[model samples]
Target: MKQLFSPRADRLLRGFGIIGAAALVLAATVGFALSRSDGTWGVGTPAAQPIPFSHAIHAGQIGLDCRYCHAGVEQAADAGMPTAETCLGCHSQVWNVSAQFAPLQTALALGRPVTWSSVHRLPEHVRFQHAAHIGAGVTCAQCHGPVETMARTVKTETQSMGWCLDCHREATPQSASLVAASHAQFGVEVPPLANCSTCHR
Candidate 1:
């Protein structure tokens, strides 16, 4: 009634709202990108083990199969960690006297497991079965990268939900094989890749 509001007030409010929305979107996009980046997930960072075991020597130069150590890959959800006895089986003869073998020896002596740092680990809520992937002919190198070339094991892939979903969506003839194998092995129908139950639960 008294011309208290400027004619440009409504326009200024609308412009501020638009700019704020744009800024929020930009912030969210940048945040998502950063979360999905390798640095955030420690990809390509090598994990130090109690013993300086060289996958390059074992898997690359020596040509040992991954299952030689990860014995449960084809039968269990977990790709089992190699036991002290597994290491001592060869190191007992090869580098038995070396100080490097001390931990292995102590573990075996104490009848305790050696705690190896995990390089590739999914969230607790995500259930990954190595057996299913193996049955579908997914090689260890596919997910774990070229461990044969690595002196120390590192997470080479993101192994994120999006990354995993992308792989499942893109599965070719292997998808059929995976489904068949799942039915045969677990007696459950393979759900769609995007199904929440596929990886979760």
Candidate 2:
């Protein structure tokens, strides 16, 4: 039987396919880069919560301490979110009928917590311990910036490994506490906090 396509046509089709694929990959790469670098994602991206929970009004005006909401920061590996009871404790007495708080009331009545969007999220590959940071006297502001002043929660810092190592390598106010914790933790080997194992684990 005669060949359906000439050898030249076969080569041209293969070349076109390769070129088309490369172009598609280039376009996809550019789109992904724009997605990450644009105002859509990365540091300073504000999260819209189910309710308009203002840190400025609660923490700044009312002077509610961080611990009041993040009750497990000093004890748990993860800083636990505020329970529905915690929100109800205040909301039940103040602004209980506000339209903005409708979700809050519904969540409370349903015995579920408001699914607040995460503002400062790290990659799944990395692990962060809130207890260790808290024990080291690294105040929330050291990394989260002045959160009390934010009307809406925003990622103020680049939660990158290099950015973390830079802070760890510096002589911060938490050095003393870190040293103390290190002594209690490591006993003798004073491993640098900037070590890959310090954070990557």
Q: List per-prediction Cα lDDT, in the order shown.
A: 0.80, 0.77
**lDDT by residue for model 2 over 37-70, one digit each (tens)?**
6355467778768887889999999999998999
Models 1 onward score TM values of 0.76, 0.67
TM-score of decoy 1 = 0.76
lDDT of 1 by residue, 100-164 (tens): 87888788889888888997877899978888789878898888888899888888888888888
Q: Find the candidate with the highest lDDT and give its number.
A: 1
The parts of candidate 2 lying over 4 Å away from their true place are 1-41, 94-96, 171-191
Q: Could you tell me the C-alpha RMSD of candidate 1 in Å?
A: 5.1
